[model samples]
Target: MADNDNRDHNRRDRDDRRRNADGGRPRSGGSGQRGYGADRGGNERRDWGSKERRGEGGDRRSYGDRDSRGGDRQDRRRDDRRSSGDRDNRRGDSRGDSRDNRGGRRPTGARYGQRGDDFTGGPRSGPVRQGFREERMDRRAAEPDLPEGLDLADLDPLVRQDLRVLSKDNAEAVGKHILMAAELVDDAPELALQHARAAKNRAGRVAVAREVNGITAYRAGEWKEALSELRAARRIGGGPGMLALMADCERGLGRPEKAIELSRSEEVAQLDREAAVEFAIVIAGARHDMGQHESAVLTVERMNPDRKDDSFSGLRLAYAYADALAQAGRTEEARDWFAHVVAKDEDEWTDAAERLEALD
Candidate 1:
């Protein structure tokens, strides 16, 4: 009885080892899990080597199957469709050569699946197409022509070089308008402003074009426009030239306080001799505009106007001093300074001769 009992126990142990709770032998692979397929009872699991079990009726999709198989199938289908269409286009064939050849349908007839416009085999009409073309032509014709006075050949070589940022053809066209603007600035300043605007529209990024626009606007007394363009030019390329003009524009707009503030900025201190003289003149004018005539005279007097130098800046400095004195009610001293200005006014660039005669 004892030997029979031991043999029975050993047989029971072998049975447990060969069969699991689900009634199948352990798999031979890693972790000895079950197969990927499901049984009729919907209790099957995969050999993913993890303890996690799927919920009841959970799908049997695996991560590797979805990524490697599904992704590659999708990519290959897309490539095949593209390559087939490209081959059809290269062959220039309309018949059975098409990727989706629908019984050799002709390419030029009613779009394969859609109805033609009039059943006469023509493109469908939407908005009046000709009307758009006509409107575009009218817009082109209505645009203002570049001024006839524009002549790039007349500009100095250095001046022309400033437009090198633009293409050669664009530079020449914009350069012409700039030259025309300069030519008309004195006699017809408003027209000069128009020319300058044309150049700026063509090459708005060019510093020289912006400078011309600002200067022309200043000449035309368009104070707001001058200030904006000059400020833009200065931001693009820092130079001391625009400071005085910008300050004067401030005075033009009845902002003498702002003008004074700008004149005293650090940039004004670094100005070259010509810009410095112009800055002084504008500052003095701003003081006068604020009804501080004595202060204006004092500002100009600080320049120490010497009668010896006949440079343009020297002449302008002297003239500003004389004007400041006249405006300050010091007529005798004003006349003496004006006389000094007239002696150097050979070209008569300023109205110094007329100013002295008026003082007399």
Candidate 2:
């Protein structure tokens, strides 16, 4: 019995040693269980397995390296694309800025005055602008021989010639100088005309001074004198527009009959469309007032009605036609023309319908 117990104890001890070597937990010596070290090693193996899920070689270092490298490459690609986009945007902005600068930097006024500023060209600016320039450049009484009052060096090459003709000390020079300054004061037209007359004895004979005198006389309401000067200008180099303007001045002075005669004159036949319209409108109005209804209708019919699309004159005559028709007791026809004007939104012709309605 002693030998049997001893053999059983030896068997248990061997089994315990086997369990301890295998890294398992030993519950009891006789029960043949494992040690604490065996449990710890098993836990460490489980940690390694968890790490191997995301990394090679069973460690977190491998996963960290992969994630860090991938992030760096992606960030570099994004930075490169952003910088390229920024560069492209800058280039487009520069092109747009350059275009805008070019447009605004050009001198528009200088170009507009090109024809008038040219020495050989008749003059700078239209009639109104030229008149204004002459008024401003006229020498003052305080400075005699130098009438331009402006520094010659500062004057544009364009205006220099016109200024030169104005600097002489003759009678015309003084008269023109005073007249030009007087023009700045609209109320001094008569006084300036007197000054122009006085300068005549100084300069031998200046037609320009005579013209200035004539204009001043006209400004003072001397219609006969205006007609005289304008007629003399016409005898010289009067253009179509100039002739028409002279005719308008005569008409304004209560001489529409004389004005109408000039329009049919051989030399004034080349009047521009606008001047023709003006002449026709005045003639029509004149005939209407003089109780010449047939003549007024003929006057309107003479205008190029097709050009209505290009100018206001056609429409103007249309209203006049409607008025004449109503005056002649033609209500139905007049209403059609008046309605046509209304359809086109002509506020000026709206009264034509009311006139026709009065007839109705």
Candidate 3:
């Protein structure tokens, strides 16, 4: 009887060890107790082992089994942790797992089989969010209202020729907007910009419309927008008429070096006399902006300030030369040039009178 009891006891010990090695519950009738995966409160704990060893309806997998299933162990662990609400509550989601509930990762478009527009990790709150908001607002902004008595005939004939590519109604509307922009540019630059924007919205592909919009934007001190529209105009029209304005816009934006570089471009040679003179003035202004006053004076000298022409370019050249002379500390010469500009500027286009008074 004692020998038989010893044999039975040794056999039960072997069974307990074998159950522990298999990560299963030990023999309940023996001194060994249940292990981690044992059933508790009628709920069977998940078995992290091979599917072949798991009972029916068991979907959990161990590290080695997960490796054969074609995924890293860490990914499997993350999925297991997420599925167990108790585990997630006990230990917060791991940062290494990007798909956690805290919203730290970009959407995996393939997971949902649909693309998402929100590329940012979380709710965007900085410049990126502001940019999207502004874009939406721009798309929803109300169109500018046309003023009474405005007509397509008021637009310049050259500009009207470019609008022919648009539909008749759209061409007329764009032309009217351009005319309003031109008329209001000197007095109400903001209103002019509205009209210009209206024209661009209606006839964006037309070079003349873009040119007018750029000019109005320049008048309104929108240096960056002015530069962009002017570049678009240049590309579409293949004209150098607005090169001076574009360079001046660079000066307005505090990019004097870019203004100078633009002035030196080969396209400057293609500009008409007035446009060339305007470009030269822009170069001189850029030189002044860089504190190269003496160089600015030299730039203006190349335009022949001694010429007696009383045209618009002549007045602009004289005013710029006088300003350069003033900046260079040639006070007497500057005073003389300013007086000349004041005499020839019959339309009071320049502030030469004020400058001359200040010099005196």
- On TM-score, the candidate that comes out on top is 3
Ranking by lDDT: 3, 1, 2
Candidate 2, 72-154: lDDT as tens digits: 33335446655655665666655443233533222234543554433222223346755655554452332333245533344
Q: Tell me the deviation in Å of residue 33 in model 2.
A: 99
Q: For residues 147-218, what per-residue lDDT tens digits would candidate 1 score against the true structure?
A: 565567788775676666466787887887787788789998988888898887777766678889999999
Worst 10 residues of 3 by lDDT: 117-126
- lDDT computed for candidate 1: 0.72
Tens digit of per-residue lDDT, candidate 3, span 221-306? 99999999999877666646598899999998989999999877888878887887888888998998899999999998988976
Candidate 2 residues lying further than 4 Å off, grouped into runs, are 1-165, 168-222, 241-245, 248-256, 306-310, 323-360
lDDT of candidates 1 onward, in order: 0.72, 0.52, 0.74
| CA error at residue 75 for candidate 3, angstroms | 54
- Tell me how far the alpha carbon of residue 128 in candidate 2 is from the true structure, in angstroms, after superposition: 34
Q: Give the lDDT of residue 187 in candidate 3.
A: 94
